[model samples]
Target chain A: AQSVTQPDIHITVSEGASLELRCNYSYGATPYLFWYVQSPGQGLQLLLKYFSGDTLVQGIKGFEAEFKRSQSSFNLRKPSVHWSDAAEYFCAVVVSAGKSTFGDGTTLTVKP
Target chain B: GAGVSQSPRYKVAKRGQDVALRCDPISGHVSLFWYQQALGQGPEFLTYFQNEAQLDKSGLPSDRFFAERPEGSVSTLKIQRTQQEDSAVYLCASSSGLAGGTHTSTDTQYFGPGTRLTVL
Candidate 1:
């Protein structure tokens, strides 16, 4: 079974500061990884994903993630943070059957 | 034209009551999925449907949970005799195709606003 782990429960960053969210996964083979963000009272929105080819994948909202096969990690990163970036972020791993296993989630708070 | 849409944005049901959540996927989407998001937690996979066939349902927590996509376009998730623990936001997402193959899972999954179910 594929499982994801997000080490951070909550992270606070000042506006305009760089941000990085750590994510690790346990899978028997190469895994499909994804990052999603959820705002209050709303469903999750995709931040980025990594499947094959390039190790670095870019997504919406100025976010990006790099897939590291050796580390079994796909961490999300952003050059600068904004207030609107404050939300709950999730790291997920998809199995061959398309079943997605998600981490507990990390809540991001952008401080002014 | 629109993205995924779910009905009854909020549902309140007493314990032991039955509840049904509806999801209308984007037209032409071949894959639909159901997920459960508990308070302060990431969304958990509940099930997946490829067209009218339910290809995977290993994530459903219990037998009380049921889902159907009869026509392959719209899907419904039903919980029988809901328990207090069943209270959570039920989210629906749609993708372009089934898992595996050259198709990348990184493709965006359009999600609905979700149905917040409260089992008191």
Candidate 2:
């Protein structure tokens, strides 16, 4: 069985500050990884995904994540976060037969 | 293109009552998925369907949960005898299945706004 762990439950960052959210997964082989964001009362929106190829994958809203096989991690990062970037973020791994396992999610609170 | 859409954006049911959530995937999409997301938690896989065939339903919590995609375009997730634990947002997503013989990394999925289910 595959599982995902997000170490942080909540994080606060000031505007214009760099941010990084940690994510780790346990899978037998290389699995499809994805990052999604959700605002209050809204459905999740895909931020980025890593299937194969370049370790660093860029996503919308000036976000990116690096797939580190050695670390079993796919951490999302941003050079500087905007106020509107605050939301709950999730990391997911696709298991066999197209089933997905999602992390507990990290709630980001942007401070002015 | 219009993204996936879910009906009855909010549903409130009493305990032991039955509820049905609907999902309308993107037109011509071959794959559809249903997920459950509790408050302050990420979404959990509940079921998956390819066309009109349900491929996987192992993630459903119990027998009270049932899902179907009769014609392959629209799907429904029905919960009989709802419980407090069943209170969560139900999300639906659709993808254009694997491209060629290989899966494309960009086989991106489009999601609906989700139906929030509250069991009282």
Stretches > 4 Å off in candidate 1: B99-106
Mark the regions of model 2 whose C-alpha exceeds 4 Å error after superposition: B98-106
- Measured with C-alpha atoms, the lDDT of residue A30 in candidate 2 is 82
- The TM-score values for the models, in the order shown, are 0.95, 0.95
Per-residue lDDT over A13-107 for candidate 2, one digit per residue giving the tens place of the 0 to 100 score: 99999999999999988889999998887778999999889999999999999999999999999999999999999999986655678999999
> Which residue pairs collide, candidate 2?
none
Q: What TM-score describes the B chain of model 2?
A: 0.93
Encode model 1's per-residue lDDT on A1-112: one tens digit a residue.
Answer: 6778999999999999999999999998888888989898787888888888999999999999999989999999999999999999999997655567899999999999
List the lowest-lDDT window of 10 residues for candidate 1 chain B: B99-108
lDDT at B107, model 2: 64
- Lowest lDDT sum, 10 consecutive residues, model 1 chain A, at A93-102
- Reference-based TM-score, model 1: 0.95
